[model samples]
Target: MDLELRHLRMICAIAEAGSVSKAASALGLAQPALTTQLQRIERAVGGALFLRDSRGTRATPLGDLVLARARLVLPAVDGLQDEVTALVGADRIGQYRIGATNGPVAAGLVQRLSATRPASPVTVHATWSADEICARVLAERLDYALVGACDPSLPAGADGLVWQPVCVDPVWVLVGERHPLAGRAEAALAEFAGEQWASAPGDGCFTACFATACARAGFTPRPPLEMDVGGCIDLVAAGNAVVLCQGTVRAMPGVVPVALTGSPLRWRHLLGWRPGGPAAAAAGELHGLAVQAYLDVVAQRPRYADWLGTNPGFGAQPVTAAAVSRR
Candidate 1:
């Protein structure tokens, strides 16, 4: 009758899949068995967790509330299990789990970490938002994450963690190669007002940072088309829409990344981790590794690299002791 981790996971799976059958399939349980289990869980929790209809299953108000708390609890429990397992088996001690926003930095970090510690197997989760990565770190699911957030918006709540500033990145506009303004070195943000934009939705501060920059340019951007990362880039390549992204963004075959006039959109690269954890203890070493990764990625792109060189302020700076003290 007591609520257990398995019970919480089952409800979460059902809520997310929006169907008991699909959730059962995902969990490798028989439909009838899952149904029986769900009934028992509802009895323990004192209410029906899901309302089923032809449309699909939906979480009830109480179910929704429980599901929110489950997400926060489940990851921490998983992390504790990993920690205990590591203590019992020294060989498993070096496994590093990381979450990061999708970009060259995350790719480069994985490559460098592997080379730096061949014995440590690296597991990565590439996401659209640094805030999500930091949340995982707080939950003890990630050793650390490379995140970026600008003024007026802090990444991952800016609480219960260490924040190490790695570098400053400017946001750039991307357009199709054949577009009229593609060859321009720099253009005012207002120049692209007529163009449609495609960007990944719900990326916390990223969407707001872009909007604030646009607002400063004397206009508000049109509502963006919600899509995945590939879709957003594809829209740019097709000349149908433009997108805004970090300076670390790679140049696509048919998509050109150009700077904005006066560098309106700027964000700082930060290393997010639990205070006094392994990451904070080894902060200097990780910071150096990240700097090399950024340089390596930048060197591969002729236009972006050239711009980066001329703009001396854009590259990684050494992580100072004072910066670590602030956390």
Candidate 2:
């Protein structure tokens, strides 16, 4: 009874679904069969990986350790399979696989790439984890990754990758049209001290960076409601909470994106890839396309473009040899 990749995947699915029955359904197996398999896995590992109760299932400490390793292993293994398959089918070698977290840049890049190279296939993989995107690039599953992180910090899992700065964007607030400050071009952070906050979930330093910014504004912020981008927009439209978003956030019907006075928090967009991978040959061209895409997104957001003119520090950064380095 040796632990295998399937076993690790089962463990992760159970933890994610929070119940064996749900996990079994998701994995297309009988509930009892899944339970038996879980029992065998527990025996092999010599411990109970999960604690089941009336509410739901939660991972034990041992389960946590197993899950961490599974996350790393699964991507690398999947990437290896992809690379092997691509090698067998040399015709697919010219395709561009772009990975990114939520933002307008990836979409813009894909559009530009398709227009410029009509014969080359372009695909975009979107995730909430910048580290996962970088991991996929390192594993050769993706040719390049365009991700954003808080200022002064690089994306995690970038040990052997080259990173180039695409732009520096100021974090802005999203408020409903009816909100008192919605009409203002800029609002101070302290103005929202008494309001509730919401934001999309991501694996980055933005959470800590936001908290520190709020603390400096002379008030402690409540734990923000973490949800997807759509959900965050819903909360703002309903006037239940305000959200923090990139300055280049698209215009919404009932919501407004307002810059924070003095730009207390900043986000840095980066383009990363393996040094000698397929993307290396066109790294300069790819980076230029990415920067242009960012500018295009900014252009669509008239208010943000206007704000950028007043704030020189918050737009595309100049790319130089100094800006491109291995992390």
Candidate 3:
């Protein structure tokens, strides 16, 4: 008569794991709480549920009956959680304010309406850094953010936010068209060991990758000029120096994309937001768009902003396979 879902779950977990401590870890609950559940269940059922030995807890005859029923009920409960997740993903709220890193995400943004609702107040702001965007969203000043990684280390004290996968950005070593190493399908650290690089500030993954690569090659690549990411391609094209470029900047013109054969390196873009907010509805649509945009680019959609010249309407043309194929 005292049987309940919580009691059933604890008993099943204990029976399966064979130990209360192990069950507690699996359920993210405390061992004391799990033990309390077991004791309460035994009293309610009028029989001890487990045969405790030196090894661990095991199901008694009565416990076996309880576990069998639990095996069936637990799966249904798990199914319910899955359905709730789908329900959340499919939800569309009317209006919400938003912010994102200021950049063209291929043509992905084209998949949108003017606002979430009919005349519902919605604002979308664009900024320079992912941290800035995430901060605004966490502050409740903005509802959601579309941002690329900044600090390779995810910000600490980010309990107020939730994250979703966006895309993987490959960091390409960029060299001038006339550079001696530009002719190769891939670039090597030895080719530019003593050369200067245009590096941006931050411990971003791309920057970390480049530094590590250079360190392995017995050299440290000093920046010819430390500036914003936009300026690196210009420096590379002018032959001032080579800049280890991220996937985000590879598609921009005036730079050649050279793969690194020696090690693994990639940058990730992520969409993040607070748990509950007005923007929840639009955040879902934008999250899907961001993912699609990333996929389109990863499939070598070309036409990356880095390959675009410093002219108005430059990004209008996508980078053709033939263009990057020459790499």
Candidate 4:
């Protein structure tokens, strides 16, 4: 029998489970049938891939080699399937579907797009995971993804997507009005060394970036309490912990977002879509609207607007001439 993708998957499953019986259960196959299939796979490969001991199954050198190749091949094949599915089920000509992580831009962008194209049906899906949003875009469930990432890192699942920058905002600290640092125009990271930190849950590099910043400031950060946005705000307002937030975050009742002195951490908002897909035809218009939406949000936060004026490079990035022409 020729080695097929399913055979490779089964091999990987057995290697991962460390026992034929366990792998069979996980794969929803009877042990005897799985053993018969395994024998056929072994004959096709001309080697004993795994060794069975009384304890469990372990991969031989040949099995390790096969596993490594299977790992690479599987994801590539999966990506190809997603891409083909997207092409086959492209969005309707006048419809717009956007996926977004927690941020200010998505809502505003949707509003602007609906206004611009009154006949077009615009929709937005919210999530806490940029990777999930991007995968949806790749799978054609979303025409675009508006998400934020730590300044220098791109979202995962960006392989075949085109990402355009909307803006770069400084990361700020949220503290209660009663907190001593609340009155300060800007505070240093070292000042928060002993304070407990809380933040909205997200699948991004911000957590690692925050940790590195704290280490550079000569202290280790406590593992931050991860919760929804409202929970994070509650923690900050109660003075139980401080939260990291974007500069454009609006004022809460008792919480204020203060800039970090040296701007140790920064976030970049991005709008991504599958290249050459239906969204590509309107990418320029969508990107322009996204940038304007971000600017509008910044305007609502006077403190952040003034900070942007003083700190020139942290606002809307100039769209390059080449980028404009491409769009």
lDDT of 2 by residue, 1-327 (tens): 578766787899999999998997776545654676688689899999999898899999999999999999988988887878578545546788889887767888889989998999898888776766887787677889888878756764566788888899888899999999999989899999988899775655677678789999999887777677888899999999999988888888899988899989989889988887468878788889898998998888887788878888778876777545544
Q: Candidate 3 clashing pairs?
A: 93-281, 251-307, 252-305, 252-306, 252-307, 253-306, 253-307, 253-308, 303-319
Candidate 2 ranges with C-alpha deviation above 4 Å: 1-92
Q: lDDT per model, in order?
A: 0.75, 0.82, 0.59, 0.82
TM-score of each: 0.71, 0.76, 0.54, 0.74
Give per-residue CA lDDT, model 1, range 24-132, as digits (tens): 7776555654776688689889998899998999989999899999999999988887787566544424677777765556678779989998987889877654545
**Residue-level lDDT tens digits of model 4 in 69-158:** 999998998889778765757447789989998887888998999999999998888877676677678767788988898886676446
Residue 313 in candidate 2, Cα distance off native in Å: 2.4
Worst 10 residues of 4 by lDDT: 318-327
Off by over 4 Å in 4: 1-91, 321-327
* Per-candidate alpha-carbon RMSD to the true structure: 10.4, 9.6, 17.2, 11.4
TM-score of 3: 0.54
Q: What is the lDDT of residue 37 in candidate 3?
A: 49
**Which ranges in model 3 have alpha carbons more than 4 Å from their true place?**
1-93, 102-107, 110-123, 150-159, 201-209, 248-253, 298-327
What's the candidate order when arranged by decreasing TM-score?
A: 2, 4, 1, 3
lDDT of 4: 0.82
RMSD of 1: 10.4
Candidate 3 per-residue lDDT, tens place, 209-246, comes to 45666687778877445567767667888888777655
The 10-residue segment with the lowest total lDDT in model 1:
150-159
Comparison by TM-score, 2 against 4, better one: 2
lDDT of 4 at 232: 85
